[model samples]
Target: MIRLSRIPHQLLTWGIPMGPLMLLRTRGRHSGLLRTVPIATLRHDGHHWLVSPFGDTHWVRNLRADARAELGRGHRFRPVRLVEVDDDRKLEILHAYRGAFGLVPFVRDAFDADAGAEPHVFAREAHRHPAFLIQPAG
Candidate 1:
């Protein structure tokens, strides 16, 4: 979904200091073509996870169809497996994100704007959105 070439320089500019940038290579559900995206990451307890602020994007759908993906951080490439969080864990992750980033209000407002609904309702739906924990393959 994100144009990699256009943002490569900018991505590296911001990615260098704020932890490793994630490159997720996934297969298109309909077209069966491979798609890659660079995303921000949060590492929790040795596991890497991605939080979808805009929930259910094309890349997320690709991961759902095929859990196996290639992750590139800087020049290292590693194989990762996607683990989708359940409802309870998703809530926990959301809270953890809010606490760690201290961006609760911004997150809430963003979800509201994206969903075009009231903050309360959109917040609830955002919590239900699927998030993935990426584990390095053994």
Candidate 2:
């Protein structure tokens, strides 16, 4: 199962250009080396919200250590700083993500937003998802 998940991520990280798929570059939390991960990103109302479909994953930790990361799509890349969204906003963003992406299993499964769930269902645990508001890095 992990292998299956890795293939697409590997493709997006190095070899594909499909939709809004993006490559996020962050410094390794422990190694202090650069690490890249492909992420399915969603943007709304001029704000880019990054969802950690897989919970508070590695890249999330890396960002915690250093709030700056580079967002890359196709050939364009921009440096951005992560401003951790508060729980209230996280729930709202998660709702937007669910509606836009059709309840991604990785996220819905964790937040229990499957089928007919209220948009605010994720509120109680929104902090666990670790969403961020992106801003141009200074």
Candidate whose lDDT is highest: 2
Tens-place lDDT per residue, model 2, 28-119, is 98999988777778898788888876677899999988999998854567899988887567777877776777645555566656535575
lDDT of each: 0.63, 0.76
The digit string of per-residue lDDT tens for model 1 on 113-134 reads 3323333333466554567898
Candidate 1 lDDT for residue 93 = 59
- After superposing candidate 2 on the true structure, give the runs of residues whose Cα lies further than 4 Å from its correct spot: 13-15, 73-76
Error of 1 at 28 (Å): 1.7
Candidate 1 is scored at a TM of: 0.68
CA lDDT for candidate 2: 0.76
Q: After superposition, how far is residue 14 of candidate 2 from its true place, in Å?
A: 4.3
